[model samples]
Target: MSRIFVIRHSIFAQIVVWAIITAATITFGLWVLTNATIQRTNRQALERAVGVDLAGMVDIYASGDKDELAKRIGDRLALQQRDGDVAHYLLADAQGARIAGDLIRWPGLHAGTSESADIYIDGTNRAFARSTQLAPNLRLLVAHEYRDLGLLLRQVALVFLTGGVLAMLAVALGGWTAAHRLAGRLERINAAFRQPDDAALEELARGSAGHDEIDELASHSGNALARLKRLAASHRATSDHVAHEMRTPLMHLDNRLVKALAATPDAETAARIADARTEIRGIIRMLESLLDIAASEARRGDRHGLAPVDLSALAARLGELYADSAEESGHVLQLDIEPEVTIDGEEMQLTRLITNLLDNAFKFVPPGGTVRLKLRKGPRLVVSDDGPGIPEDQRESIFEKFSRGKSCFGTEGAGLGLALCRAIAERHHLEIALAPTDGGASFTVTPEFQR
Candidate 1:
């Protein structure tokens, strides 16, 4: 039963039902008023007819012609069948004995004033009676059939029912249409809130602006998404900061241990210590790079205060710095930079970004391979290497924090370099992309970024 109620009492159905009820109430009220007015008008007309008949009867009595008066009154009433309910009349004497007409006996007629009552003739036909004095010793009685008013009332009720039914149907249809329209809008709002993820939420928010309830719902959803994004960013930043800060002391300890191990005198013991120190140094370096990445990310907000920095000069410096290391490792480091190309950014961070890219390229390139750094006035920087290039699928994943391609599994460095480069590029609003190369990977950084 509860389930049935739920099915039947939908918003549209409820609206239609209420509308029908209201329409029925109005129709019934009008019907009652109409019937009362009609009955009142008919009653007034009947009263006037009775007065005229009484006057005529009194005139006949004054002329001492009772028989003629009775016949005339009966003929007059039979001809005037306007309602067909008008009472028949009879003349009676002071002793309550009927003198003429169809009345069998006069039953206790009142004096000095008119009296009305229901009467029956032959114990069958029902009628309404009114009696009045015709003279000092005579009276006139009139009767109308009770069924006449019943017939009039039945006709009025039939008309009222037909009209009321039609009006109720119209009202129900209109109300249902209005309620369904409102429900549809609410359903859309509910669907928007049911989005599965943030991207879906953002898309829904973009589509939900208008001068209605749906618009209000969309605006609220957008605000909630924005707050969630801010909270996630804040949490990430805090985690990075804590990890970076904790690594500094560990790095210092590892550096001290390395120096102590280098000065030991026992050959076998020294060899073992040296190996341990090397592992510690690797850990130290990884920690330092992690700290650098965190610090760079922290200072990202200050990128807007950057002045113009020369990319060519920066590239030349890196080339000179890495040239001897490349020579020792049997690889060539080349620079092909145009002079005076400038960009707005923190010079220190850009230098670090370029240095990391070059270091990464050199690590993958084999002996006799070339690592080229090119800076041009197209206001762009390009770094490329003739080495085993990153696989197509791994290129995008490599830019994420701690993500490394299969080729770099045994490499000495943590995989924060490219991630830091991406962070820096984002901070400076520069466009960074990997260009597809046949033999090796190439990367280009545009001076101005647009999203």
Candidate 2:
């Protein structure tokens, strides 16, 4: 597996990314809502101030004192300047010209009408104001300038922007911390199974001290792997016991049959003894095949005691050894063994796998047939024989133990050849399948999930 795939596909990675996105979305939404609320409140406050001050101006106008109102405006302006406060005012005459205020000109043509208008200062409307006619010849206006409110809004925006950025950074840092820690621990668990050695499993054992879900998972997995190891050991011991108890008796019976054949000189009786010896030999071979199958099955998925084996050299050597037999049987044996086709495996078992397939090929293939042993760069091994092809019906069962229904030319076999071959292939994490062929049978061996 690629390291990139392992890291990027982690569940923690997805959670981390989603957390950061959600945090940013919420931060921006709250910032917009808060800014809008503050602006609304500030605008309402300015409107209230203008309304109250305008009402007071109406009281002054009702008193019917022109000098007093003018003096009040002058005093208010002086007080604002002294206190560094900003306010706009316009007390225009009925002729649409400034009379007693700092407004550069009358906002628009006016008379006894009382309404609202923009307070223009130096040719720019800077405030909203209300106007009223005071005794037909004078008008009063109290303006609410927006200069201070704008400065306050900008200050609020700067504070919000800075806080939002800090909040997002804090969220990202926390998410990254969580993702990195969780992903690193889970990756160690995955590595334990990929390589499956004691050193690899140490992380899982160490995780038992923690109280998180991953620790619980690690504890359970370690127990399960330990149990599997025990089961495999027991299975191997049983297989060895059966081989020992059965092979010795069978070998002794074969020796007795051989002696009987030698002592019995009568032609008819000697043939009978020889036939018995052949039966004993067949039984012994069957027992050995059964032992091989059991042993391979017991050790399936185990990587202990495995080492690099050169398939190219093994296949070439076997082909050379079988060359004379192919010539004697008048068959063509072709070897297309590419050099340096290597993989991690047990050399002895791989040898048995290749020889078993070749034995079956030689057994069923007639004279002048072609038997090919091919070893390719993918560590792909293929043994093909141009004999009578397997029937579609028998293809599924042929690899099963004692399935000799497809045994050609009445050949005698215990039918464990292909079954043993499959066991050996699976023991090494290789797949052996009867590949599609127009004639005869082709067995291909390749790694699972090759890419």
Candidate 3:
């Protein structure tokens, strides 16, 4: 039973149920109201009819012919009671004596000089009565029936029930149509997502757009597809660049090792061999950095490890280390850091991000240029270089894996520095922005701690 209900249940079902309930409530309410109104009006009409009959009875008794008056009253009662229109009749004297009528006595009567009283007669209770004065010594009473009013109300209730059922059917049909249309759109979107071919699925998802729920589903699907495509492209480009960059250094090292093995060398040649080995080690370090970036991107949310480190002190130290190099190169290196700005992260990765930015800046900046580093509040870091600035069009693309700007074409590095920075920032839920500078590039990093 539960499974059946689940299969049949939908928004349309709910709408139909609500409509039926509302219709039933309204129909029952109106039927009850109409019946009460009609019953009241019928009772009043019966009372007026009994009043007229009493007037006629008074005239008959006033004519000084008692037998004729009794006969006439009996005849009128027989005519009204024959077809079940009037149910019963009664007559009474001032002394509460039953003078004429089918019932021998009136039950629940109040003794007062009143003109009329409602009384139940025979087995069924459907009667009205009125009393009149023929003389001071004699009183006349008349009664009438009103059972047909109940039958009239029953017929009206039947009509209301029929109309309510029809209204419910109409509402149900409308709800079903609406739900079917909405569900069809959703089914199409789901099917598109399950398709094997990426391009075909994208086209199918795009084609669903119209002025309906299908359009909204299509829009969201398109956005998801675009993100997936971008991630895939970044991954491929990073892989290719890493392979090519590592291959060059490895080939040079291989050739140098071969030469070292073949030469009849003394101390100087041995020193040259050692230098080649160091250069190869530097290449290995750079390749490891690239691998770290790829790993970070692949598992951005996975917890690896963490340590507490002072970011501000680290930034100041990096500035000091680069200061002599900047002076010898005729550029100024300035640092402004707030103390005790500590955070929990992989210290090595953070240091690599800072080192990459500084190295890129130094490589691009000419003589008389400046590199500025600022860290504050444990959450914000700014690095600005007075070098050739990135063009507006290239700024957005420069952070993509292996995407190089004009100034970086001849630089001694694969273009993974900015990409790695971006991946690290994302892993920490940080915002990184590249801003335009007067004569160079400025980058701002806002960590999640600040938010």
Candidate 4:
């Protein structure tokens, strides 16, 4: 599959293969056209020469001069072995007997029927034969050896074939080199945009001096990156200001509720005040979750300030830390973490992501149930709990901000645990997905494949 992808999709391979195919197609077309033209012209010349020679033979036999049929026969037979003498002749009697000729037998010879044919006197030589009846008892055959012309044509074909191959090779080499350079430039542009940081955008802007289509694309990308940075910063600031402004007032309201509860000795009024305080805390939790979600979303794919984290050791430590809580809740905690698993990521954010997932699992899992955490060499992290799994119908929606699954209904969370997990995964160039399980909820985390 990877090989097919390279051949079918990679820019360098595509261009080289396409160029070679086009070059070979044109080369073969020229060879066929040129060969046909040469064959047609040569055939016409041979027919004309044969017609003239037969006429000259008949005129000699009828001239009332010395019967020169045998003399012309002798003339050709003597010259048959010469390099320039490409003619073959035979003077045969009416009794179907050859008097003189190189051919052993006639090849469907007749009078006034001229067409091109490959008449082989032996195995190696080829000629076109023409014959006529001059005297009632005398018949003559004239054949022109075009073997030299055929040899020349073969040589020409060899030249065309070799030239075509060489031309295709040259095109492939040149196209591959050109495509390689072009692809590298394109990849640099893509990599810069992937991170969308100030340094990457600055580098992209600096490299646009070439002024080609690629450089033009880089220039546009740099502009987009700048705009993105500005927008993200603005949105982050606005969210922070709103959260701070609202939180201060909410805290003051909570204090007033506390004072009202203290002042009112009536049990019913105190219950109402406590309920208000609970609602206030819930609102605060929701606001904090929203802020975290916003920040993670804005930082998606940002590699700035990331450090290598030992994921295996981290998972182990987290698992050991949760063991006490699991024992207190009468639930089992299992860890199957691979050793030395590591990735480049924000450690605090990643810790929050894992903690959220584990906390979610522990919240839903019943007493005496098992919650398992596994980490593999792929940096794949999976946390599963033996509890009522999420309904398939609500799985997709559960990843939306403030959207909760059927199993999470009335749960203490702000319904943003899974959403925040997804956001944090995206920030670290990872993926978070709900995996199907027989009788439990299972969440898997791994590197995301863009394609």
**Most accurate candidate by TM-score:** 4
lDDT for every model?
0.74, 0.79, 0.71, 0.83
Clashing pairs in 3: none
Q: Which of the two, 1 or 2, has more TM-score?
A: 2
Cα lDDT of model 4 by residue, 1-451, tens digit: 8879766878678778889999999999998999888988877788778778767876877874334666866776776676763777776777657776666666667643433355776766777778877656667788887646668778889999999999998998899888888988888788877677688788787675678888888878887888888998999999999999999999999999988877866998888889889999999988998999999998888887799999988899899999999999899999999999999998888899999999989888878889999999878999999898787787888788877654433555668988999999999999998888898889999999721
- Against the true structure, whose lDDT is highest? 4
What TM-score would each prediction reach against the true structure? 0.45, 0.66, 0.45, 0.81
Report the C-alpha lDDT of model 3 over 1-451, residue by residue, as the tens digit. 9966854676666766788788788888988899888988988888888777766676777775656666776776667636655634445566657656666665544324535667666656657776555555445566777757657777898899898888777777776677777767666666555442466456655665365656866767766755765686698677868777776769777687868757868888777777887677666766766777776676454343656778888888888899988899888898988888887667777887788888878877777888889888847888898778887788879888777654533645557788888888766556667866677888888865453
| Model 2 bad stretches (over 4 Å) | 14-207
- Ordered from best to worst lDDT, the candidate numbers read 4, 2, 1, 3
Off by over 4 Å in 3: 1-9, 24-30, 58-71, 78-81, 108-118, 131-137, 149-158, 190-451
What are the root-mean-square deviations of the candidates from the true structure over C-alphas? 20.6, 7.0, 14.8, 4.2
Poorly placed runs, candidate 1 (over 4 Å)? 1-12, 63-68, 74-86, 107-109, 121-124, 146-155, 196-210, 221-451
After superposition, candidate 4 runs with Cα above 4 Å error: 1-13, 28-45, 64-67, 82-85, 93-95, 112-116, 133-138, 148-188, 197-216, 253-274, 406-412
Across residues 1-451, which tens digit of lDDT does each residue of candidate 2 receive?
Answer: 6977965777776787777788778877877898788867766776777778877877886785877777777777877863333566678777767767666666663435667655555656366677777767788777766545567667877887787778778877898898888777777777666556665565576675667898888867766666666687787788788777888887888788778777867998888878887887788889888988988887776677789998888888999999999999898999999999998899999999999899889888888899999889887889999999788898898899998843456766888999999899888998898999989989999986562
